[model samples]
Target: MSPPLRIALADDQALVRAGLKALLESFGDLVVAIEAADGAELIAALKATPVDVVLSDIRMAGLAGPEAVRCLRRDGDGTPVILLTTFDDSTLLLEAVEAGAQGFLLKDAAPEDLHDAIVAVARGESLLQPVATDPVRARYAYRDQDAPKANFNEREIAILRLLAGGYSNKEIARSIFLAEGTVKNYVSDILDKLGTRDRTRAVLKAITLRVI
Candidate 1:
């Protein structure tokens, strides 16, 4: 039989952490390897033992979620990190994405949604909470409606198209014949103009606004 997906969770609230542990354990194919109360503990736990996926709260004591992600990436750890947040602030989401988080999930997400996200991230897929989807779409829709006289430029439109196609910055650069740094700059500009947080939100917003 295949090995179970080893998992780790980090959250500041003890009750919340326990609840998540219970929910994750309810899945027979997943194993909870460790739990941390904060980002520092989470990093320490990771150093002691590696896991397939790390589900972490974005706001935590010690090192924040984004910082932890940066540390992991800097250390060349391939484990996927999923940021869990209660708020839908676009800035936080964008920062986490720029920090190299593999997935973003809302704290109120359903157990099944969390499970699916974990599985998807474990399998190298990006997962965005469904709840965030519509708001993102709405942000883009508002932009499009407000800009009846003007539309996204060719490069911006191309970037949006590639985003909808699930291309990361590196992939988009390769496909569009642009430097990775240029793609990153465009993504930042896109988020700024569309008023969305992350690439996932940008993609949904682009679709709703018909910008692509």
Candidate 2:
């Protein structure tokens, strides 16, 4: 079997970091290969040891999650990040995502959800919880409510639901027992239908448009 995916764990709270490390390792498919108390430590540790995913707190003593994500992207390190927050702050969530975080979750999220978020992000999927999604949808709701919704067939709607669930094309393909390339095509069509090239935005637009 392939080795477990390496995870970089970072939080200012030592107990929180320890708890997260234990919980993540308990999954057997994930391993906490690096641990840091803050973003700077996380960044420096990453230079010495590469990891598949990063689980970090949004607020830290120095070099917060958003800035850290920006630094990672600036340095061309495309490793996915899952930012953990204690409260539902849409602004901070958006900042982290805009800075390049692939996933955002509350610290109190269920263990399975946290695991799924990490795995999804590691696979290059974008997953934003409702705490953030609602604001975006409301603010960017369709301009013309009377405009007919895009003619999305049932199959496309199913795919869009999975997209909203934060499943990557590969995962969606496997779940539906369809070919990955076919799923990619479906995603392309979804984006085309939604009139947005960004998958995350496409999902949001679909919700705002009430198509999915």
Best-fitting candidate, scored by lDDT: 2
Off by over 4 Å in 2: 132-134, 138-148, 168-182, 195-198, 207-212
lDDT string, candidate 1, 146-175, tens digits: 433145788988887776654567778999
What is the Cα-based lDDT of residue 23 in candidate 1?
86
The 10-residue segment of model 2 with minimum total lDDT is: 141-150
> Could you tell me how far off, in angstroms, the CA of residue 104 lies in candidate 2 after the best superposition?
1.1
Cα lDDT, model 2, residue 32: 94
Query: What TM-scores do the predictions have?
Result: 0.65, 0.82
Q: What is the number of residue pairs that collide in model 2? A: 0
Q: How many residue pairs in model 1 have overlapping backbones? A: 0
Pairs in steric clash, model 1: none
- How much is the lDDT of residue 119 in candidate 2? 82
Cα lDDT tens digits, model 2, 41-131, are: 9999999999999999999998888889999999999999999999888777667767888888888889999998888877767887765
